[model samples]
Target chain A: MRAAIFRGAFAIQVEQIPDAALLEPTDAVVQITHACICGTDLWPYRGQGPYQPGWQIGHEWMGIVQDIGSEVRTIKRGDRVIASYDFCDGTCEFCLQGLDSACVQGGLWGFGHEGGQAEAIRACFADATLVVVPPEVEGDEALLKAILPLTDVMAAGHHAAVSANVRAGGRVAVIGDGAVGLCATLAARRLGAEQIIVLGHQPQRLALARQFGATDIITSNGDEAVQQALEMTQGGAQAVLECVGAKETIQMAVTLSRPGGTVGFVGAPHGQEVPLGHMFSSNIGLRGGLAPARAYLPELLAEVLAGRLDPSSVLDRTVSLAEVAAGYAAMDQRQAIKVMVRP
Target chain B: MRAAIFRGAFAIQVEQIPDAALLEPTDAVVQITHACICGTDLWPYRGQGPYQPGWQIGHEWMGIVQDIGSEVRTIKRGDRVIASYDFCDGTCEFCLQGLDSACVQGGLWGFGHEGGQAEAIRACFADATLVVVPPEVEGDEALLKAILPLTDVMAAGHHAAVSANVRAGGRVAVIGDGAVGLCATLAARRLGAEQIIVLGHQPQRLALARQFGATDIITSNGDEAVQQALEMTQGGAQAVLECVGAKETIQMAVTLSRPGGTVGFVGAPHGQEVPLGHMFSSNIGLRGGLAPARAYLPELLAEVLAGRLDPSSVLDRTVSLAEVAAGYAAMDQRQAIKVMVRP
Candidate 1:
């Protein structure tokens, strides 16, 4: 089966890997129908994150269940479903607490398990890890790309909004213009933010941010961006969502928030250190971690099916599974916002 | 007038000083009736925090309004009131958001104004900074000690609980056995926590913790405390209150909380740095800063006035204004939980 593999830094390849098989009673095999290159995928491609020479590389995926182990009772063969990046046993204490990201036995798809950018993938904890697409929209290709976001990015954006405590009529500042940031802008809007502002310099991405519910955009950085946000909010935003994990973005999140507001960060932080005294003096609340995507699936998926959210606007380009390297290169070179692949 | 001054490391002296008088139209002078030596006060006494010899040193006090500036409308001469450690304008955006600690014109009691550990204090923002003692309990000394906590420690503890999102049926673990920790135990109970645990080795402080509604006590530190907390909670406490600003206590607060729980801290952290990756991977929510005591006052003061909440048990000793140095020495030597100064 053809799958995406990390050959080296700046080198991702579409190569034939061993086929997946049911390894446990709780496991299910999924035939890859659609997949996409994620922002995190660019981490290794840019030599920013861990680089393994030969490991399966994608996590966001949606496909049809080709087969299931005996223990899988809720899902069966040939059902379209979205599998979140994280797989967890639904009954663990952490899972029950809506912290599936910290589930004792949970595993991220690209690590320990096979990558989703393949012909088929084997998923453990199938009953608790997969969410079936509503029947009415399952056959549409456009809807496929839209629903695929629920597997990771959209849910992550929702987590950022929830962490920042975004509410109806609240104001939010989204830092970063990546797919996740755009999704967060949209999520904050769906959560009823009266003022949605995006801070980014990229023209194409910023345009998408506006379409996704950003009421304004500041093509600036540092204190300049902060000033614009404060001026727009008439003081400072109630919530600041840091979607890019860079230290600069994190600092900007703090700078853009009001004294009593919150900053929610979902990006994997890089060299970020919080000045305790400043955070204390300002009474700013910092929250957010890995998204409990599975925990948010049912509600967000309903929004997607109801046509209330169209997250696939982030998918600016598409390709066949065999041309996966081109997909990675395009996003890496900033030639495309995101890439979708049909297997 | 006379006031305590930081003479040098491990040295404080009660010496003759200029009397407090109203200078600003928003100012009001208070005749110090009672004051308390704070845990933060011991910082300079033990040579830990910034040491400025001869600087006015106390921040918590309650007294009768001695005089008022022409603009001071809320408080009048001869009225009993509590002067909190923080002075906020009460009309700023941050103040209106219930975050008086972050008020734009706010300043600590001793910095830009006279410290309260003197015969009198000149308080700024009088209308917003002082809360009147209920008429029914004005002359009650026992009730005075109880209501005094509402000005600082009790309100700070309540901030920790509110920051950690403690709710009915939740479990709480309070680290540090100082006045703030004991008060946090009381506040968590008031916030409706089902179980409360204190982690400290001081027997007397632990006894006070129980009296303040702690259900259990763990006299350990480091990983040992973590293991015991895990065992007691069968996982971890729902909320961990870090009242000690040391590096070790902050780490314990993170280590002792459940995966999805929050750690609320009110201590003025001394050079603390967070391991962002560990906190993120664990899905622990860290929320806390300086407490907005003024926002929490009316409710807590009501409880105190109603004879439902008593926070003065932590005040284990008393001293006259002339014996201020002795009060500091006793508290610095761990011979007293807290010292109540009668000016």
Candidate 2:
């Protein structure tokens, strides 16, 4: 088997690795059909190395179940399925409470577990970790591409909306024009937000955000951006989805919220500290964290099947497993919004 | 007329002050029949003075309308009414959004405005700041006492519960046993929480909490309290009410919440900062601020009128206008839970 390995800053290598096999009775082996290079992948590549040298990388993936261990119950070999970023024991108390992100036995892909950007990967707790693709959509490439994002970004976007308590006929502001932010815009629309304002620096991404249901865009940054958003919303938005994890962006998201409004933040924190005093005095709320992708993937996949959401456009480039390094470079260099890796 | 003045630490004086008159066209003067010393009042008495020398004090009160300015429409002389701690123009964007605490034209009593612990208070934005008492219950001394807590403590507790999103059959933990925390326990019960845990140190206050519907009480403090609460609730509470605003208590409130749960905090923040990293990782949320008393007063007042809520027990002691200084002393020494002031 072959996998993409994180080989220090600005370096990735596709190399032969031991084949994935059933590591536990509850595990299943999956042959990757499609995987993705996430914006998060660029973090280690940019020298903020949280991963050790030669670490397995990549998380978002869809595949065909190649084999199942004796204890695997809900899924079988040859099933078409998608895996969320984190694998969890579906029966954990937290999982039952709809907080799969907080599952006691859960761990993220590629950090300490099998990386999804490989020819094959072994997944534990198969019954609770994989969402089977409906048979009708299995053979449709475009539909599958649209559904692929549900494994991570799209579900994350939905998490932001849900966290912010976005409602029909309510106003929303999404900060960031990345894949997650665009998907958040789509999620806000799907959840029936009447007015969506997307604030981002990238013109191209902002355009896509408009297509995703953003009613307005603020191209400005910092104080100017906050001022514009506050004025446009007549104070601020009822719900603000924070898709960028930087401290400034987090503060901006908080600033963009109306009194009694909520900021649903799915951005992975990077020196981000919540301004409690400001939020407290203004009656603003903060919610959302790492998306419970496994918990939300099924519903979002249903939406894709029903033809209400298509996020395939987020993947602007595709590569083979061997070219995964180039895919990472393209994303880091802003040459691609998101890169799909096919094996 | 006599008003309580903050003369500095451990000192309060009932001095003859200018009679409260219509300070604005939107103002209404209410002769104070009842006023109360809040736990917050003891902050300055203990030397954490946000108020300067001679600042008029106290904020919770209900009385007959003494007079109304030309612009005061909804209230007039002789009408019975209760004023929220803060005066807000109800027509502001924030006020209309049910965040009266964030109203653009709002200010708290006793800070820069006319204090309630006076013979009369000239409430600005009269139509918005005061809730008229129902004629039938207006003259009932016991019922009025029950309703008076609604002006501040009870409404604040309800705000905490509502902010925490306490739902029917949900499990809750209240992290205080003061007037506000006891009121919060009552609010949780009113909201239909099936399992309510009150964590406090004082046995008497805990007993009061039980009467207000606390199913369990943890008399321990610090780590032991957190451990007991976690074990008792089989993890943690779905909604944690933080009525004490110290740094440690705030952290404890966050620690006590179940994953994906919320901490509704109404404590006046005193050097408190949110633990954002822990909260984000656990999908925990923090909400609530200064209670939007004006917004919740009517609903809670109705609850009182319906014989559903009685927070009068929170007012364990009372004092006359001249003895307001003694009331402050008793509260500072924890000799009284709350003190009612009469002029």
Candidate 3:
């Protein structure tokens, strides 16, 4: 089997690795048909965070369950499925509360487990960790592409909306123009937010934001963006979705929220610090974190399958397993919103 | 008229001042019958935050309506009423959303306006800023004491519970055993939280917490309290009400919240810093701030009138206007949980 391995900063290589196999009865081998490079992948790709030299490197994929261990009951061979970015048993106290990311016995992918950007990968806690794809739509290329993001970004976007308590007829402001941010715009719309203001720096992405139900867009950065958002929303939005987790972005998210409003952030924090003073004086709230993708996958999948959601547009480029390095470079350089990997 | 004046650090003096009179058509004057020394008042007394010397002090009180401006409609002369700590018009966008503290035209007491500790106060936005006392209950000393906290602490505590989303059968933990923390315990019990854990440093306050419906009490401080709360909760609380706004207490609140749970804080932050890294990784949420006491006063008042709530016990000591300086010292030294002031 071949997998995308992190060699060093700006260096990724698809090399032959031992085939993924069932090491436990609760595990199943998924033959990856689709995978993607995430904004989070850029963290390690740019050497921004600690990453082992030779670790597996993908956590978003959907594939056919090629094999399952004897004890796996809910899923069997040949079944199509998509595993959440993080795996959970769905029975732990955390998982029961829909906080799958913090499941007591769960863990993230590409750490000790097989990477998703490979020919095949071992999925533990098969029944709870994997959401089976509908049999009728299994091989539809466009449909599969649309469903792919449900594994992470789409669910995360929904998490931001849910955490922020976006409601019908309410106003919302979304910070960031990344794939997750775009998805959040769509999610906010689905949640019935009447006004969706998207703040971003990219012209093309901002245009896409409009298509994804953003009623307004601000192309400025930093303080300028906050000013524009606050002015447009008349004081500030009722709910602000922070899809970018940088310090400035988080601060802007808080600043653009109305007094007594909430900021729901899902961007993986690097140097984010919540402005407690501002939040305290304004009665604003801060919520959201690593989204429980597993908990939201099914609902988002239904929306995709029903043709109401189409986040595949976020995947603007594609690459083969051997060219996964270029895929990372494209995303790192902002040349592509997201790069889908066909293994 | 006479009022409590802030002379300097560790200095409070009663001084003769101009009688309270309406400055705006929307204002009404109230003759103070009862007032209270708040934990917040200690800030200026201890010289912690910015405070103007010779400025009036105190913001929690209930009294008979002495006079009303031409435009004042809802409240009239001789009607007993309680004013929220902050005055608002109750018609602003923020106020309509139950955020009276952030009212567009609202302002805190004791800045330019006469403080509650004065013999009389000019209550602005009379129709909205004051909750009229039921005629039948007027002049009832015990009932008035029970209802006085509704002017601030009780309503603020209910705000914590409300902000934290305390629900029936939910597990809750309250940080701080001050008047507000005790009231939060009562609010949590009213909200139907099954397990109410009160964390504080004082045994007497903890005892009061139990009387207010705290099912468990932890007197430990800092990391030890977090550990005990985690162990006792089997993980962490589903809802945590942060009544103390210090940095260490804020961190403890975050550390003791279950993943996906929320910490509703009402403590005026001194040097509070929310640990975003821990919150992000654990999926914990932070909310609450200067509570909208006016929004919650009516509901809490009704509870008191029905014999279902009584928070007056928190006022263990009482002082006349001339002894208000000593009252501040007593609370500062933790000699009294809360001190009542009669003008």
Candidate 4:
């Protein structure tokens, strides 16, 4: 099986690897149909995070089930599916409470387990982690584009909006104009927010954000952005979706939120210290984290299937497994919002 | 008029000061019958916060309205009332949304405007800030005690629980043993939390916490208390109320909350920095600050009038006007949980 393997900083190679198989009773073997690079993948590629030299590197995927273990009851062999970046036992307390990201036995693909950026991949907790595509939608390009990101990005965007408690007539702001931030703009719009502000400096990304339902845009001057956000919302945003985890982004999200409003931060924060006094004094709420992707995939897929959301718009480039390294380079240089790779 | 004035650190004097009068068109002058030293009041006296010399201190009070400005409509002379620590224009959007503490024109009584620590205090936004004592309740000492804290501490505790979204059958952990913490325990109980853990090192405060319906107590031993709380509540507390504004207590509160749970912080956080990465990764929600005391006072007053809640039991001492300085000393030395001062 050919897989995209991380060799070193900014280096990825499509190399032959041993075929995947069911490692647990709840596991499923899937033949990868589509996979993509995520912003999180850039961490290891940039040498900012630990990366095992031959680790398969990708977490977002839409594929066809090739085989299933005995305990996999809901999904069957030959089923087309979208699987989340992390696998979780659905019956766990955390999973039942819609916190699949915190499931006791959950494991991250690409990092700890085999990932989908390959010809074939092994998925654990198959029944709970896989969302089968409707037969009517099989192989549809638009649906596939939407489905692939649902496994991660779209769900992450939804996580940001939901955690921030976005609602009808509320004012919402997205801090990052990455794929996740654009999706968040759409999510807030879908959730009935009357005003959506996207803060980004990149022209292309900001334009996409506007197309995705952003009512306003603030080019990344932190102070001016916060002031504009507050002024536009008549005080401050009712909910701020922080999709960029940098310290400046986090602070901007907090500062832009109205007193008693919520700041939903989905971006994985790097080296950032939060001012506790400021947060406390403003009566602001903070909620975010790794997306409970599995918990949200079904709903996101439903929306995608209905053509209500189009997460595929974020895909700036698509390539074959052999060109996987270029996808990383394009994303690293901010040349692409996202890159989809065919296995 | 006699008032308790902060002369210096650990030094207070009860001396005659100019009597307060209506300072604004919306102001009212109140002749305080009772006032108390809050946990925050001890901050400056303990030399832990910046204190200006000869600053009049107390903010919590129950009194009779002595004079009303032409703009004061809801409150009039001779009406018995309970006033919040902060005065707000109730007609503002923020106030209408139940965020009185964030009112644009609001001013904190003790910190910014004339406070009720004196015989007569000028209250701004009288119509929006004062809650009248029900005519049916007269000469009730317990109700008086309960109502006094409702002006700030009790209301703040209730805000903590409400802000954290405490639900029936949920588990709550309160990190602090001050008046606000004890009030949080009571508020959590009122909100129907099935399990309540009060973390503290003092026996008397712990006993009071238990009396206020805390089902468990964790004698502080660093992270051990958080571990015990997590173990007791299965994964972690569904809601954690941080009543101590110190860094360690804030950290402990976040540590004890389960993923997706809320950490309601009502304490005036000092110089503390929280790690955003840890909080974001855990998906714990944080909400709180300067408890919109005016918002909760009506409901809390109802509970008190109905004999369903009593907050004054936490008061360990009561001093006359001349000995008000001693009340601060007692609280500063940890000799009293709360002190009620009679004028």
DockQ of each: 0.62, 0.55, 0.67, 0.69
Q: Residue-wise lDDT of candidate 1 within B90-143, one digit each (tens)?
A: 998789988898888887776435787889988888999999885777768899
The Cα error of candidate 3 at residue A63, in Å, is 1.1
The recovered share of true contacts, given per candidate in order, is 0.63, 0.57, 0.68, 0.74
Q: lDDT of model 4 at residue B131?
A: 91
Clashing pairs in 3: none
Candidate achieving the largest DockQ: 4
Q: Model 1 scores what on Cα lDDT?
A: 0.87
User: Which candidate order results from sorting by TM-score in descending order?
Assistant: 3, 4, 1, 2
Q: For candidate 4, give the lDDT of residue A231.
A: 91
Docking class of 2: medium
In order of DockQ, best first, we have 4, 3, 1, 2
Error of 1 at A284 (Å): 1.2
Q: List model 3 lDDT by residue over A1-343, tens digit each.
A: 9999988899888899999999999999999999999988898899977878899989999999999998899999999999889999989988988889999999888865678999999999999999998798865899999999988999889999999999999999999999999999999999999999998889889989999999999888888888888889888998999998888888888988999889988987766356788898899999999999999988888999999999999999999999899999899999999999999
* TM-scores, one per candidate: 0.93, 0.93, 0.97, 0.97
User: By the lDDT metric, which is better: model 2 or model 4?
Assistant: 2
lDDT of 4 at B166: 93
Q: Per-residue lDDT tens digits of candidate 4, residues A232-337?
A: 9888998999999888888888888888798888999876466666677678888889889998988887888888888788998998988999999999999999
The weakest ten consecutive residues by lDDT in model 4 chain B span B270-279
Candidate 3 on B62-89: residue-level lDDT in tens? 8999899999888989999998899998
